[model samples]
Target chain A: MSEKIVQTSKEKQEETSQQISRQWKLSTSLGIMFLVIFMAITVLNTFAPDFMTFKVIGNFTVTYLYSVLLLYIASWSIVLYYVIKVTTLEGASI
Target chain B: MIEIPTAIGMVVLMVIITMGIAIFARRFGSSAAEFYVANRGITAFQNAISLGGSYMSAASFLGVAGLVWLYGYDGIWYASGFFGGYVVLLLWIAAPLRRFARYTVADFAFGRWHSKSLRMACIVFTLISMMFYVVPQMVGAGDLLGVLLGWDYTFAVVVSGILMTLYVVVGGMRGTTYNQIFLCIVLWSAMFITTILALMHYGWSYNALLGDIGARIEPGIWLDPLNSFALALGLVLGTAGLPHILIQYYTNPSGKAARWATVGVLFIIGTFYMMTPIVGFAGRAILGDAAGKNTVLPLLGQALGGEPLMGIIVGGAFAAIVSTTAALLIACTGAIAHDLYVGLINPEASDRKQVWIAKVSTIAIGLFTIGLGLAFKGYNVAFLVGLAFAITASTFFPMLFMGIWWKDMTDKGALAGLILGGASAILIITTNIMGMHTLQNPSIISVPLAFLAIYFVSKWAGKMPDDIDDIMHQMHSLHSDIK
Candidate 1:
């Protein structure tokens, strides 16, 4: 009975490892993507100031309101939604 | 100037409500587990509110607004980093940590490597980081009280410290958690109403205000990319390393609840942070440079709607300071009691003894912080908070992330990383404080050095625990059946 229990535990551990790996892959990729987007926006706003400084909306420049909104959407809303979706899906199916 | 009576009334009311909840929570806390983590019974929503309240701090409530009021677009980057940190927490650290760790981050480090010395190092760093973090909140409390109620700085600090200590001593994590939830609501509502009133002064259009602020920006001030990147990086990485913030995960019922709490934190804090920029912009456009920069929001409240609104805003800011200070105090107390006294000196200590030690530690830390807060009365609250973040980012972030993800991490590497990272951060910040302007954001250099220290030292030392694979497996496994 103990041998069978150990065998089942090993199987569960392996299954958990696979699930965690998949989750890590998704989350890390999304995190890196967001970091890159953040860095890109910072660089664009820094070096090519004119491009981002131009009036994109009514008195709002590309750097002022637009970049912030873009970051919120891409980094926060999109990334978080996917992270929750992926993690919760695994939880549900399990 | 604030209307003394009204502001005093509102602040007193907030304190009464907060302490009432805390005293009520005391009934649920008796053992060390109950004291430290509320027996891990907090729901996702309550945990979220508590996390939001603890995370926001006076640094976010007043410092961000003050910075934005002072620095234009550059200041908003601070808010961005603050908000972005939760994303990192949500994806990387939150769930896995909740699943693996029982009490504190030190528990995980010790559990992984079975090193008493490593746990001691964690205690040292956690105390240093938390004490450093607490001073600013205490200072903000003193400043706000001095302004609002005509109290002396020392009196204000003592009052705030004693009140926070009472909450933690009486109620422990349960009390602190509920108090934090009430504080977050008060803080968010205050900021939201103030922002709306401020926007109304500009005819209710965010675009109009943003456009005007954008148009009025001085050439080089609004677009410094390097500093912006450094500030943003520090806020993001530093948050992941915060001892108080990370311990909030343990308050939730499960790893899944912790993750959901992070989601709730994201929306709750995101809304509060969004309001900061409006306050900053409005303060700049309407009040301009006339008001004391740090007191811009409070002054704006007075200017817009008189004593009643200003009292509400001041009350909210005070709650932000107290809630954050309470959280930091508890974190520090845990390090002393659980990590040091119980963990190292007296491993056989009973839970009742541990709880007593924690309560005593809370009082000691509170008194120590009050002294530090009064001494550093004139320092910028935001900048001081930034320095604390840099220290955490350098010391804790590298060790934690590597420990969680990499199987090759050794006790030797973690120790070297913590010592070197902490030393470098302190040296750089001290020099910067003492007039060396080149290394303002020490994390840009210190964090990388810490990571390299861990990486290179781990490779060279090549002496990991035999059960490292098993430890890693445990950390990765979603279920907690191994124990």
Candidate 2:
């Protein structure tokens, strides 16, 4: 009876760790996806320099509005999302 | 506006305070853990501030502002890449490395593979990347004293070198951490004062600073999609690969706190970086192209608020050099004493012996850094920093990414990638320095090649470690799971 209980507990632990990794995978993917969009904008800025300098609003160019402003906000947001999501992951008690 | 005597006095006071903190923190440095990661009891907030302090070297504080002042929109990209890197660390590298919770990057590889050669490889690469890193700080520190105190360059280098070595050898990581925390706040506040004064002068119009569009960019910077992309990639990934910066994460209390601290660093540093470009733009607006190379921040501070303000800014700049050089010296000490000596040469060594060797190694490595700095004094400081990042991005980032996330990675594969990746990156930089005009950065080519080297070599080489599942669980899951 004791042996059976030990086996059951070991199986349960494995399942829980697997669940933790899966959740990390989901959150990490979201962070990477956000990065892709940011990098895509950087690519456009380099390839389309003239367009990047286009007056988006009040003499501010695309590069300034996006690279200067949006980059900071996006990086901060995604990382915040990551931490919040990870800390709440089941079995990631940490 | 540039008051030499006041500046010298302020810097001298700052150094005295830094020495005091190091000496006081020595009580906490009796053991290896206390010396290395502050016994892993550092609060997330403290870790965050030191991370910002240790990271905002002369490279970020002075280099970025100078780049933006000279290159305009093109230069802002470096700061963006620098901040963008924290996201990568937060997403992938920070938690796992903290979970491993070892002394150095070399320890991670050795623990994973149980291979002495692999551990030695990491130590070599760590030292090499660090050597590349120290040159820039030495160069910057010498130049800073030269400008602020009118001291000769070599004399300034020697004085700064001895002062940095004294504190770290006595106090260890605990001392360095305290100094970094104090110094980063001082430096950031100095930048803050300069920014507010600049904006106030312009009636708080950010766009007013941007009015001179035609003269924004000099010839051929942040252009050429290939070059820009390469430079940006090196800048972004480089932060994650940096040994000193990543080591700070281990100071956090847990994996979760490490994640939080990583994000905190982005915000702390993010605000400082944002101000850098503004100060740069203000310099361009006020002084045009005559603002002097790598001296934009001090010059702008003097112009806006005159001598007292410039004195504070320059004093903060001195702190920047000292804090970063101390941080790097501690890292070099780790490469020698922790990673090489204890981990390799004398695995059974006592804790008391370990601490003693660490102090000796600190002096040796500190002197070596100063010697290299004196030798490489003529190179541009910013370019040297970029070279350090590129080599790190090429070698370590690929290895850590695969090791942390992929369980199938073999020791043989990692070793192959470590050597090939490091060699190719250095080859390009060295050749470029000899005037081949090799791409200004090597990350564009080297990162992919390094990843491929590890991938193909893993498929073709040594068997995976027997405890791969246990390692993965330890790195990815909660501590309870390992039980």
Candidate 3:
């Protein structure tokens, strides 16, 4: 296979400076979104001990489903959202 | 003399197969790419498996279940930090890092700053993290063998150390990559088999299992909110800074490929983590109070499916240790041989000479870590891994984060952050070991301090790389190409 370093065209360069800020905004904003939810769950699990232990379904309590199961679901949803959005916004994926 | 034949048989086969692959890879892996990064042609799926395999270690495979059995919800919350880390990587670090780095994290640091001292500082931080990282796996491997296979701990550690050193020297990264992929399959399959059997034993009801566990163990018994908070901080940030984990992503053919692979990594590890708690709860409900902290998986295997099941989990444990220890060795070799010997001492060195240095360095590192393992017998495996992550979070996480995004990041700023972050973290860990015991994980204090150090020092230092804009374009733009 042949190989060469990437050289951005002048038009692409202008486009990319805009893209970088947009991508950074998207990546970081989504990243912060995930971190905040995780930390909040941690605090709830830590301090609100009685609230976390209330059984809502069968033996599955708020701590088990909301803190762990839902947190995992949210984490995956964020990861997939990032992938799909990046591909849609750009012709190529970053 | 007593032995668990099923476990011994399967584990022996695993060792033989990996040993065979290492020898086979050594014969043909002559080029820089072949030895260093699997010829830089690993597919997304393969890289994903390797990434999961490298990260799983004994801590994830065995310790997660053990913790959940012992501490209930508190355990999974602490362990989830490992998964929490990749979110940071997927967002901020993965792509730009792959595009910017050539061989190791030092390459990325030096590429940004063009300072030999900064590169050496990168190596120092990498070495400290890798040393802390490698010992736990080594000690875990020895302990697992001694408990299950009945081997002497010293003999078990020495043999595994010799095997790993020889495998790394022969196979390099290419061999490590393939071994990691296969080992990942073995370990994940073991988790699947054990968890499925436990569910089946409990009438296949998730509710039934949780009902039993909640009735038996009070949720309040597992609460340590402060320690959990600190641990979560360390794992979430420290994972992004791991030296062994960082280099594997750079092995991808392109920056985009690395990002794509991470999606799979999250899914794979996420699935594995979800299953671990089941095994933990199952062990508690079924075994009553018979489960030991790290022995939950193997014991659950015995209770769930007898000796064959136990064998698979035991073999899976060995695979987890071997894959992680080998990755650490290769990372150590890259630091000493590729970064130091080739980058500084012999810039004009031949390909064969570079490979030779890497082999010698692997031997030296293997001996040093094995000695540490034998000396610190019976140390908690998960605690050491968490400490390693905390230090990495304190140091490398800051350097990589700012170096990629912040344009004015100067060499002096980078070095200052590295020293301050790494030294402070080590001080905390040392004092904690010496009974200071003030904080379980210091990342809560150290991570923000390191980030602040980089920012203020860079602002005051007043010199930035001339090609900062071009480098940024290479990392962020679609037109940025890879060779």
Best-fitting candidate, scored by DockQ = 3
TM-score of each: 0.94, 0.94, 0.95
lDDT of 2 by residue, B1-483 (tens): 244776787888888899999999988648888888888877788888988999888878888898888788778878888887888888878878887778788877887777899999899888888888888888877777787668788987887788889978877888888898999899899899999999998899877777754557322455566677777788888888988887777777778778878888889999999898888888888888778657888888888988788888777888888888888888788889998999878978898999899989998988888798799887876667777898789878889988987777889989988888788888887787788974778888788888999999999998787766666666776552110
Query: lDDT at B393 for candidate 3?
Result: 96
Regions more than 4 Å wrong, model 3: A1-16, A92-94, B26-28, B215-223, B380-383
Model 3, range B277-307, lDDT digits (tens) per residue?
8999999999978888879899999888899
**Which should have the higher TM-score, number 1 or number 3?**
3
Q: Best to worst by lDDT, what's the order?
A: 3, 1, 2
How well does candidate 1 match the true structure in TM-score terms? Answer: 0.94
lDDT of 3 by residue, A1-94 (tens): 1212345567765766777777788898999999998888768766786887788878888877765688788999998899778767656434
Candidate 1 or 3, higher DockQ? 3
Candidate number that wins on lDDT, 2 or 3: 3
Determine which window of 10 residues in candidate 3 chain B has minimal summed lDDT: B214-223
Question: Which predicted model would earn the best lDDT?
Answer: 3
Interface C-alpha RMSD after superposing true interface residues, each candidate, one decimal: 4.9, 6.3, 3.1
Q: Can you write out model 1's per-residue Cα lDDT over B314-385, one digit (the tens) per residue?
A: 888788888898889888988888888888899889878888888888888878888898899888766677
DockQ of all candidates, in order? 0.36, 0.34, 0.48
